[model samples]
Target: MPKQIEDQKKILLRVRKISGQVQAIERALIEQKNCDAILQQICAARGAMNGLMHELLEVHLKDTLVVNQSSEQERSEELQNISKILKSYLK
Candidate 1:
């Protein structure tokens, strides 16, 4: 597990890079670049965004909803629910 501040910094950096990739994609389209190349760029951007979303959700689960369960039973249940959500998202 990462420290909260470090995780935030990583997320922010990814978001910034994604923004740049989006701008590149826009320029590629406006310039009428090759369709396959443009599609590849778009796919890269989409994957980056997906990764960021996954990281953010994981951090949110760790920091918020699953933070205060002191009992083993409660923690186990929370983890199960979290796993289900993650599976759905990844799928």
Candidate 2:
């Protein structure tokens, strides 16, 4: 398969896994599970979300900075956009 398609599939799989984790959290809440267990699940889900974000950011950086042959101005714009996204993400 093409690299892009493969990457997309991997991303989708990660999304599904994260969804499952979220559902598990919901189920735990509904079942009135222990607070510690629920907190652990929330932490797990958060970690998974962070992993997904990191993967997506890496792909975006590679596409914008390394893979594409953009002009200097375009590159500068892309960097600004990435900076804006990172600022928002960190908050």
Candidate 3:
């Protein structure tokens, strides 16, 4: 399989695991589990999400800015797009 497809599969797996962690949090709340356990799960899910975002951003930067063969204008446009995304992401 292509490297991109493999990377997408890995990302999807991470998403699924994060989803499960979120569901567990919901279930814990419904079942009146301890606050510490619920908070720990939330922390884990948040860390996983951050890790996924970092991976995607790195891949996007490399694909758009480093390995791309576009014109200067196109590269500038891509950089502007990335900047916009980062602004919203940071907010």
Candidates' RMSD to native: 3.8, 2.3, 2.5
Task: Name the lDDT of candidate 2.
Answer: 0.88
In Å, residue 39's CA in model 3 sits off its true spot by 1.0
Q: Per-residue lDDT tens digits of candidate 2, residues 1-91?
A: 2137777787889899999999999999999999999999999999999999988888777777888889999999989998998999999
Candidate 1's residue-wise lDDT over 19-83, tens digit each? 99999999999999999999999999999999997888778677655665467877677779778
Off by over 4 Å in 2: 1-3
How does residue 41 of candidate 1 score in lDDT?
98
Best candidate according to TM-score: 2
10 residues in a row with least lDDT, candidate 3: 1-10
In what order do the candidates fall by TM-score, top score first? 2, 3, 1
Query: Once model 3 is optimally superposed onto the true structure by TM-score, how far is the C-alpha of residue 3 displaced, in angstroms?
Result: 7.5
In order, candidate lDDTs are 0.84, 0.88, 0.85
Residue 82's lDDT within candidate 2 is 89
**Evaluation by TM-score, superior candidate among 1 and 2:** 2
**Candidate 1 segments whose C-alpha is farther than 4 A from its true place:** 1-3, 68-91
